[model samples]
Target: MRTCYTGEVNTQHLGQTVTLFGWVHRRRDHGGVIFIDLRDRAGLAQIVVNPENAEVFATAERIRNEFCLRVTGVVQARPEGTANSDLASGAVEIVCQELEILNASVTPPFQLDDDNLSETTRLTHRVLDLRRPQMQNNLMLRYRVAMEVRKYLDSMGFIDIETPMLTKSTPEGARDYLVPSRVNPGEFFALPQSPQLFKQMLMVAGFDRYYQITKCFRDEDLRADRQPEFTQIDCEMSFMDEFQIRDIFENMVRHVFSTVQKVELPQPFPVMSWTEAMQRFGSDKPDMRVKLEFTDVADLMREVSFKVFSGPANDPSCRVVALRVPAGGEMPRSEIDAYTKFVGIYGAKGLAYIKVNDVTNIPEGLQSPIVKNIDNDALRAVMERTGAQNGDLIFFGADKTQVVNDAIGALRIKIGHSEHGRKHGLVEAGWKPLWVVDFPMFEYDEETKRYYAAHHPFTSPKDGHEDFLETDPAKVQAKAYDMVLNGWEMGGGSVRIHRADVQSKVFSALNINAEEAREKFGFLLDALQYGAPPHGGIAFGLDRMITMMAGADSIRDVIAFPKTQRAQCLLTHAPSGVDEKQLKELHIRLRPQEAKPA
Candidate 1:
């Protein structure tokens, strides 16, 4: 309820009279004169009640932090010594002609600028927490990003279409959050994990292109970047192959990055196969910004005396790789121990390392406890392969292929952060984006003894790889691709399987027989028979994408009202018990919950 935003009034509006309504961000009293910082979402403006204005002065004196007020004042240049160059409204201050306190407030539970408060306490007072400038800026950036997404897609002839939020339960790789039905008692509807099937159906319905920014829910555990409910920028197209699909979306993201974040991502991001990514960086989502990469010493280690190196070297399913950390020879023993412990979380049994102390001679440069366990030939090979140098340290992970990759990959990222990209919660000046392509169509789940789709069941197997679906499922690669930025996967999609026979073969490879496949995805199978066009599209996690763009530590910082890692909303107290009458209306029965001891 004001003439203009606080930030909108600057030197250009000097001497103009205006009315502002906002909370008191900060209040200061210098002798009899009072100064208060009036804050709205746009930003903070300085207001001063001169001593001569007795009525306004008295009211300003009574105002405390966070007190809602309406002020009518004439904007004027601030005193030379009082100017704040850091703020948009810094050069001027409002000379209060009148001041009215619309509402009074007690002190906030925590200071807006203080960093010591726990996340729980901050979440409990989310309304106030969001008032902090950082949160406000994050949400504003999120808004701009979303709008830019719309602008880009619209310009590209993408029509915005909505899909059902309450749909039938389907296998979507995550447990669905079910809604009990009222009219159809004993039945349930599941919240859409994604509009995956609906979007495909849109393509089948002859909608050339479609896009939606919609909510998706999953009854899954949470993490720094995950939530019980999240937003996705879902899109689909018809008659476009994987190349055309990737080009359109890559340009869309580039446009958004240029428009929203003001960063121009490099065109035609370097592409690498999933196999190559795993081999070099030990992760399908590699942060190439990091100078670190692994060297395969498996061949040389096959005959070494060190069992830790030689044992895994001979196993076809295991790998012996080394990471050469620059200037790592200076790391104290305790740091190495801590690093060893860090890799342990990813299933690595132990960490093996060799410190390079001298560059003049290979044998003399090596200085590690296990130097005696490895032959000179093996040591020289590792040094040559990884390009080790004096003052560098080589860390080794020899285990099952996945475990080795996961552990070393994680270490590589951690080191990159500890050295660059960001420190604490602040990001630096550069970014790296890449396209990781050619992913395996299916992955063998050793625990379940079954193959699961790598990207999804709908992803089409490559032309020549279709035969391998039946003969060698492990070797079949899908025309799938992911857009990764600064180590986070911004989005992913693939050419979809439109042929029923190919779909059935994929289902069979995943061990889902004809009957089970029909039962779960009968509608999709039915639609394919009626003629579905060749199509592929991508879905981006808006939360994660915005988080990376904002350089935020977690997606929660970008989400308006996020739950804790336990998936409980502190602000709304969601997941609360329903009344007995309500449950009866939904035809539900109550079960006793086990009590936990304090």
Candidate 2:
């Protein structure tokens, strides 16, 4: 018999007989009648079995929760005053003429409808957990998002191309998860952190446009937004600069928002330079939902008697900045102390504040334990610059410029959510998309005392900046752009260096000696010499983008079988020990644990 999805049934099909197959969500008995809520991926349908059909009623009586069953039933309208408004087929019920149990499940560890189960427990039985409506919806949304991405890209003449997952490793980024080589005995193959190199090669190979929804693996510490293996909607195109690539991707994103959420984003997302973003908000990715902004107070602090402010202000590398929280003057001393401790996490020694009770009266209204030692003019200058009005509090961070930015930047986000109560609702409803361009080619790593590529080695320096490659690498800007939505970095890409000489120079500047560079990226360098094109591409974290669009806290919600925080598959218990024979076949020896002497 042909089967129909339970959720597809509606009142329009009343009096029509249909075969429905699903799991029994719940069973309710009322003397002569048994009602079963049959659930399939489509939705739920209430099935009624009358005692008059003694055989079917007997079969229904033995049915329990999660019992897989197929039932032939006639759809009929519910009795007067018995309709359920919560369900799509609420006004109708199915009368079962025949019942057959396809499979029976033992009682689940927890009820499928239970919302209180811990994530660990749910992950342990992911198949059962996925049966829940929420999980089903999440996966369905993910499918729709992926489809939308493919449709959008394809319409724009982008080709969906597949890249090799088993690719060689490159230096200068996160650690790679290596696969044991069976034939090579001891040598190993590394999983691609991204399809970065291959995609660039495709551009050089004259594939004008290429895209892939592929898996990438990175052996790194896990966070809410990270996994050992993840998917990216990788795209690359030839003869395109950073602006063109950014525009295409932004349009694609806007298309997804319009099609999926039915919400229209602004036409042009506001743009901010890297230096501007850092100076104003102390972060590259500043959440615009918050109105609070940082103001430089270094000049004002230069003459202040407070050494905490003067010490940092006097040093060239140090910075002193203040952030004003409006209507925050009433914040208790304990709360201020708490914020002080919070900034310490980012390397700030302490937090200083001036609570402005009244803006007009400077001396009496401005209250700060340390302000008494400062000149009134200096205090007024800070208040005026930060726009500190009545009932506002100005918090200051002083230290090395990096520390000040990190501490203040994180505090701004924390205060926006907790104190200001700004992070509310889904979608933030504002389509703030922008192309953050002209990024520095490299960042100086203090610990290593060397400069590393800010994006990657392949990124080409801006037109005029190429001359400064050896003499002043710091002044060079790359042809790179990051696509930002609201505050999140959706994706980033850059025009690559097509010439072999420039590529080698970038390697040299990154301190990758000739021998090491040849060893790690000889293939790429070789490929560059073979009639390469001026090409650039961008990659969007498909899971992250979808998760944000789906209004989920983490990308794991949208992924069907995501790994846990420790990068272990809970349902299948992956990353478990393998049999000795399997290891031997791979020509590997297990590392013995050290024995403790008694």
Candidate 3:
């Protein structure tokens, strides 16, 4: 129990005797006066002890970083020039009349202010790591965001409702984390990847509007922005179409940003279709802050003698995209090679380029090893199409449509933000919120020769495209929309299929036959048949949102207990072996491992 937080003490509280409790952030000594920085989640406060109080001074001098303590001190103004101008409590110090060491700490494995600590070490000592001020602030910001989201939705007549975490698993793209059933032999319940099905069912049940800040689990590979278990601001509504849903959530998002981050986001974010985004930026969730963009050159290169560009250009399914970097000709060849290697990771065969130095002479103007292979006419056409000015470097990506989009899109962001782009005046410094809509209902996997839902099966196909579902699934667009902040996809949703026939058609388009559909989603189909209302909803990655709001690089830093990239909890040593008896109860058995020789 404490009367005042460290960062709250000020001139107004001078001469006031108050009780404080916190860990000693740091300890210092100047001659006979002992100083300790007491820290709480509120922030740090300076506590000074003088030889006048010999016992308190002795106790303060013994304190070290992370030593938990309780203190009774008289607040007083700091000596002139000794004030910390950067701190809220800089004007005053707590003169400790009493000091009680509640708990002593062993030296931390790493200091609180230490930079570049390995993720493993930080995670292993997460409790101490969480005590760091930045971590405290991030988690607090996360809490504030959740509260504001709930408030905004609540004001909009959205009821806070919960869906079951343990439910039957039907494929929703990613693998689900399953819970073995003890009562039912050879059965399992899955942690929801999202409340997608349940939220839609709620609309069918006529809840009108429902929202939940729920946990979602996926047994998938990890990344900087992902966790095996994550949170979503899940929502759904009945009798609402795409525009209404988008408007409501957009305002909610703006409300969240304004209230929590003190940043006012623009109303009605910019919109682009899935096709346009892919063609120009190579990503549905494109970062508009970066100035680099792709221009189509497939047609111009189709008749060229160079097979590298001509081969893909001639194929209708492939694409050829060029990115013009302003004043990029000055870049050294080594940097260009490094970028070529970077694009190769995205299945690019190679990055082709022509450096524009002097446009006056067509042949002598360009400088690149590939310049000889590119016909002068084709080169001139590309230069004209891309508006390649002098001192610009035009990088080309030629491959399957998706491959070119992925590689060139990624290259755009990398080059636009890289040192060269900044030097060339290409990188812009601002945030741009956008909406990427009209996603295709199905994306055909050329490898598997099967069509998968671009968003999810429940997402309704756009009107009149119902015919395209049977005739041409590739051309079927969905009434889906995604909210993107700068580059990350903050949230996405679509109008749901409230009709049984339509839902069944979506299932069939995804290669799910009637019998299998009944086995997997019978309840949903049956519900649709019985008075399901037209509805739609969105799910925002709460961790990802908070990560951006807190300016944290990884979602892991904002999470209190995050698993490793390999999905192992370093602190708890999770995913440890289960005893044979427990497995027997769940009617499961594992194959025996071969004996190892000692």
Candidates' C-alpha lDDT: 0.88, 0.85, 0.89
Candidate 1 local lDDT, 11-69, one digit each (tens): 98888999999999999998878889999999999998898988788888899999999
Question: What's the residue-level lDDT of 574 in candidate 3?
Answer: 85
lDDT of 3 by residue, 1-598 (tens): 6787877888899999989999988888988888899999988899988899988887887888899999999999998989998888888999999999999999989889887788899999999989988999999999999999999999999998889989999899999899999998878999999988888888878799999998999999899998999999999999988999999999999999988878888766888998899888999999988888889988888788889889998999998889999888888999999999999999987898889988767879999888888889988888888988999999999989889988989899998889887877787776689999999899888799999998888889999999888778999999999999878999999998887778778888999999998898888777777688899999899999999888898999888899999999999888688777777789877777832222
Give per-residue lDDT, candidate 1, residue 50: 91
User: Global lDDT for candidate 1?
Assistant: 0.88
1-598: candidate 2 lDDT, tens digit per residue: 6556798788789999999999999999988789999998888999999999989988999999999999999999999999988888788899999899999989889899998988899889989989999888888877887899999999989898888877776764899989898888888888999988898888778788999999999899998789889998899998877778778888888888888889787776677788888898887777777667889989998888889999999999899999988777767888888989999999989898888998888788888898797888998888889888898888999999999999999888777767344433212335567667788999998799899999999899999888788998989999988877667878888888998778878888989888988898888777778899889888888888877777777877878898999999999878777777778889977667632222
Q: RMSD (Cα, Å) of candidate 1? A: 2.5
- Candidate 1 stretches with Cα past 4 Å from truth are 359-364, 419-429, 594-598
Q: Which ten residues in a row have the lowest lDDT in candidate 1?
A: 419-428
Report the candidate with higher lDDT, 2 versus 3.
3
Residue 228, candidate 1: alpha-carbon lDDT: 96
Q: Where is model 3 more than 4 Å wrong at Cα?
A: 594-598
lDDT of 1 at 371: 86
- In model 1, the Cα lDDT at residue 128 comes to 95
User: What's the number of clashes in each of the models?
Assistant: 0, 0, 0
